[model samples]
Target chain A: MTGPRETLVGITDVVKHFAGGGNVLKREKRKVHAVNGVTLAIRQGESFCLVGESGCGKSTLARTVIGLNAPTAGTITYRGQRIDDLTPKAMAPYRRRMQMVFQNPYASLNPRMTVQTILEEPIRFHFPRLSRAEVKAKVEEVMLSVGNDPHWGSRYPHEFSGGQRQRISIARALMVDPEFVVADEPISALDVSIQAQVLNVMMDARDQRDLTYLFITHDLSVVEHFGSRVGVMYLGTVCELAETKALFANPRHPYTQILLAAIPRLDASGFRHTRLAGEVPTAMDLPSGCVFHPRCPHANARCKAEIPALKDQPDGTAIACHGIEEGRI
Target chain B: MALLDVSNLNVEFPTRHGTLHALRDVSFTLDKGERLGIVGESGAGKSLAAFAIINLLSKPGRISGGTITFEGQDLTAMDTDALRSIRGNRISMIFQDPMMTLNPVLTIGTQMVETLQAHRRISHAEAKRIAIAKLREVTIPSPEERFDSYPHELSGGMRQRVVIAIALLTDPSIIIADEPTTALDVTIQAEIMALMLDLCETHDVGLILITHDLGVVSEVTQRVNVMYAGRVIETGSTRDIIDAPKHPYTRGLIAALPQQNEAAQRLNQIPGSMPSLDGIPPGCAFNPRCPHVGERCRREIPALRALGEQQVACHSAEEVAALAGNGGSAS
Candidate 1:
């Protein structure tokens, strides 16, 4: 179900480009367009998923939104306040309100710190006036909420399994009582059974805390079950954005259709994927006009000459495809 | 006879503390041109089972028992040179990470030609010609141009295709692929899997696909083996196992998948993580996590018993079947 209707975070034409191949002597520089002109709105108390394959800039866009990386252009507004360009002191409060859960559980957690210390660090950092006993109580409470053993707080991250470590990661994110959590491929490293467990914990947390999540992942199946609104990204652009049900039922964009078809379903066998020609072009050397036109089956002369802006359809989906605009595909 | 037959396989790692049974009583058969899938979580010995078949298990790990027979010859009894001859010539293996499989230092052409010359008495030019043809077979664009390119020059999907080409170059009767598409993107995974399926069909090659993805297993393999904690807990047709699983673990695995239930609901997760090899439970390795665990399940192991088209190693197989039927109806 859709959560509260209020918009929590608004991203407008965010462009994040990284400098590449630059040296002091020659001064030859190249710009790698990681996130190019993307606009999205994340509603309160909803699981907004950014789905894309590798090199699609979904992770970079997420990092930029969470203030981990600065955007080269465009505005990111949180609760009607421009937070993207805020200074460190100005962004400190938002940092506590918005936490990030990284992809690799093995590398994300500090190997030297105990689970207790890791969980308490955020709470203590956010609330410096809180007593040590208060922080410990909060840590234990969050641990129990995530279905972890409270006593295991003394254990290091390396002592726990992948699933347990992920639970700890979730616990750490929930320590500050954040309103928004940007989780980038959190459970992609875990096993399938463990993935379900972690997902259940996240869903339970979402309902209990009334939190909004910006979930980023390459796994489409997880998005189908967990995401409320899905944003399909291709080559640093949001190709399509729609409600999960509508998108899965009637995908308007050709890239979205190809992605959904590529998912291997348990109900059927053999190849059901609509094969697309060509490969994803390098981000360093982007294609002209539409980035996806090289692999899209219905690309025409116009599609290769002009970029297609994401336009709203009657079905409540925002799609970026010249073919869809012209009813060619 | 089946192209590959493994019975009562037991792989162990000898440690200072004790012997760790990495794989216990793993048994399956891959017929000529048939595709078999082994599905399990990590530490379930699915990959180790595949490795042991080719005697490719790393040092400190050895097959303590069981027999792996390929074309009426016992692979377990073969020496190093004999195993080497059978490995790439008759039975090739594809690993999960193509980057790790392909030698980074060597060019694609050199690597392919090396594999060919290792198995066959062929000249460099002939081997190069065959390598290019195999590359073209895998649908690599401009095989001639890619021949001189290094592994680093290829994308993840292209590298996997190159690995597949290397596997097919020898025309091996059986190809054991362990999580072949796990490292690639979903679109690339679909294409690679389709290519593998097509190549296997055209060449009449037997395939033993070891993966944890139930969806991939259903689409690619005709028969499936559900493994848990180094044991094959269930064996049946892919259709039967997916549509009507008889083991509680099998049901739990299928139910744990996100597609099994409605959107945004709590997926039916199996309670605990899989036990390590040395710390497996005494009776049923999955008894601690199994919902339908009985007293007998904790005290004694259940042998694999035939139930129509399926074979399940669970004392409560009948109950599980009834529950699965009720689940299907309720859903």
Candidate 2:
């Protein structure tokens, strides 16, 4: 599973920080470290999932990879090409190869636009010379592939159900024939039953289109089923990265172990959870050393003083924890 | 007698076009200190069923026909003043979004004290003392400091804990939580749920947990009601229902879970979405999406019949049970 593969996207020590309240007169300044020194490579044809709680900067990382948000430091390479610093006009070609699917279908799709118009806008923008009939054919093809009725393409987005609206969103993403997609919590807004339908559509699209996915979500169950490789993030840093099966079966980091243990499994009878001491700290005011040390039961004096770099273990998992490296936990 | 007993409950929203039956024939019972979970998709009337029990339905929505009996007293027939005494004092409710449920303008202590004083004739200082204890009971760090904070000062998970504390302030016998943890993160949800379970057990409180997560239902509740299209399609022990679900809809829901299947496999999705309240199909409301639909299922409504320890509202319950035994596949 860890065999050599073509790296589609390489993120090297990427950092995205947003400046907080500070006036010209006031010398005091604050910065929200949304993504802090994260490094990872997304292999081609793999479903790479970034799992974290809210405000952990998983969304910010996804946006940074797609060039939606510029990194404050480090570099982002796309297929052996440095594309992060490219201007909008220079990055236009990469844009066609990469796309994004947002979480909320209710807000992602324009209520005023018909599904036909929504799907065709991307095709028309990418291929302006195509005939109207050709563009319509592409729209219908994508819609049918997503298990939506092409005839319903004329209907407004508000007319469709949540599941159908998500299908439309997927169809729009596929309109440009993108090879890679960054789906930010795509199915979180849908119901459990509807989540399966949308996930099936996404898997089908991946297989049919040979598309690599940067899947970001907080749901561990979905990640176990959908992700090929998983990255566990905490406070804007990649705490652990490993194959999905390895990560689920033998989580390395303390936070990863706690996160996996906290999931309510159907096979389990009673409620049992890993008891962490404190809540997730605010991103604006990060802790001194290991960001997760405050709540980590395995944290020691060393863990509280110095941040551990993500080190590769014998099992091929990169874990950022001194306790794991020292065999303390 | 059970702490809470709802029978033949029907909730409707009368519109200009027609009366939308949001909940029909929804019935369940909660024993003392027992937790009952209502699992369903959105628009399935799980929340409406819980709302109707407390007579907290918004305008245009009314309990057209039903009996919600609590401790041998009919809640639906009670007068406003009488119901008011029972609403917060005897049966407290928790909504999904704690931020919306809590009063943003008021401090935590003020709100909890208000709730305590509204139900019991206690002095302000006594109410404040009780409120502080409840806050501490929910495990909010530094209860004294947090009591002065408003809703915006707390995080999503802490706000939910505050909401739970408020619900438990009156020492209510029954707590109807409608997706209480849905708005929080998964880890936070686990902690909050564990806290609720521990508190409920310690205090011998009956809980009516309404959620869409089957995993949470299987872990928390002793008994479960699986709802579909405004109807209680299946009701049984959580163990029995999760292990060998009798209804096609229930089986579909369990199979639809991503954990039930292998990685990258097509999930066993129930074909179509649930019907809107007004457009629910005749006969069996789930006949359209049900895998085991028959001619009788299409022509007549099935009554909830007892099969072993489970109550199933399916014309093909026996066949479905047999099918489940032979490896139930939702595809």
Candidate 3:
């Protein structure tokens, strides 16, 4: 809800391909086309959400933006500065500014380490010269901010519940007071009630710390409640980008429409969803033009041959579909 | 008599520490072709109730009390051999994970044929024919081709379709699907749910759908049983319970959903996590997290009593309903 937006993270035509172990009998070399030419920006103090099914490269794109994985092609800029090509030593300062919270808190947290050590490890790694007392104070402050009791710091992760463990993970992320956070399905592992607690914690931290978020999740409801801007990704490419309300109210892309229609609403009178014809194709063997064209009902010959560019609309939304461009859908 | 009537079903696990009651006084009735949803968070014993109905609880976890009367026969009193006859033949189950439910090495055809032949006196050729027909019923494309494919060869959605097809092979009167679509994507989940609902209606099969997602339950179920801490806190028609939940926990659960509240606003979270079964609180298990907790709630366990169309087990159900009517949080 902040005004005068300034770009915090700028991703320009980024492509990340993993070298797939091709069929041994055929002896063919191929790359898993994970993220193919995605461009977007996370403005200052806004929650930018990426929604898609499994293996859609939302995670890969988040990782690429946060410098976890270098892009196979294109550039990732932090505050207009190129951080993609920087060395690990050179990327230290950026790492301190950018933090990540993963989906599963149980697996992300070490079983042996106490909560104190887990929260303290990040501070120690990022700020090596900080005193022990300073780090402890910071940990206590972060834990309190995230609604985790400081007394429970002595207990191991297993002692705490899933919600508490997730709060601890969020606390660890905020220990550095990061300007940007890439939370990949942070609350998906918890129950609905617990999910609310974690979401509130993240929202509170964002407000208090003035943080920008790149939230990746498959659950559209969370995106609607949490995100300011939403990007609908399908088969490693973002098909549509719009403000959260605009995306939900008036979805442009056929994929986005189907995805929105698929959500089982509590208010829905009956079970109804747009059933797509085909399942997600393997990343190793992507279709000719649009990855979704095979399954898309509105796909024409142009959609089968040429990849559509992201076209800006008057309503402040971007869509990448030939059907939308030609007024066919 | 109801098609399947479970009265005061108590399931327990005899651990070394003590006997932990996993499901306490869990009672519900599933009429012919009725779609009943058992909704709860994990460890709330919704799944345990489903397992208890079929006498499929694992070792140490057994149905300690109450009667599961199906077709005027007590399933709880039946021996293993007798129960085995009805376990899959009369009441089939579809588990959460389709991959785990199906055999990895065997082709889909072999597994389906074996299951059908085991329960019914049918030839292998007949079983195969029936299996393919069932596959076609579930909308699996090219049923013949898919029958020869292994479990791993199919996608997650296709495998779930296969699982549903296998569950329908015997023409069972009842189907217990525990989180049937929880493992799939939202789109796939919607498709599977639609197919399941369609099949149940057409075949006139009773369904006991156990899931954590209230949205799914609201969409798919005719009646819902809201379980909390091993007990059915509320039971009513889907519309009534979802629209005006009488129980504080039920209200909180519905309000806690992101869509229920304003976008970007703080969700109405029920404070604290679900109590573990072994250390469930005395009196009311939900007292710790409930907003409308009173002295009576902390001292005495409320019985499920009828309040109009809904049966709610809360000391302050009337108060909750009144406040909920005013668009209040019921605090």
Residues B181-204, model 1: lDDT tens digits: 999999999999999999999999
lDDT of 1 by residue, A1-329 (tens): 54359889999999999998456688878789999999999998889999999999999999999999999999999998999989999999999999999999999999999999999999988999999899989998999999999999789999999999988999999999999999999999999999989999999999999989999999998999999999999999999999999999998898999999999989889975788797778888888999999998898899889999999998888999999888878
Off by over 4 Å in 2: A1-3, A21-28, B328-331
TM per prediction: 0.98, 0.98, 0.99
Candidate 1: pairs in clash: none
Chain B fold agreement for model 1, TM-score: 0.98
Q: Residue pairs in steric clash, candidate 3?
A: none
Which of 1 and 2 is the better model by DockQ?
A: 1
Please give me the total number of clashing residue pairs in predicted model 3: 0
Off-target runs (Cα >4 Å) in candidate 3 are: B328-331
Models ranked on TM-score? 3, 1, 2
Determine which window of 10 residues in candidate 2 chain B has minimal summed lDDT.
B322-331
lDDT of 2: 0.91
* lDDT at A84, model 2: 92
Summing lDDT over every window of 10 consecutive residues in candidate 3 chain A, give the lowest-scoring window.
Answer: A266-275
lDDT of 3 by residue, B1-331 (tens): 8999999999999999999989998899999999999999988999999999998889989888999999999999989899989989899999999999999999999999999998999999999999999999999999999999999989999999999999999999999999999999999998999999999999999999999999999899999999998999999999899989999999998889998888998888889999998778888889998877888888899999999899999989998899778874423
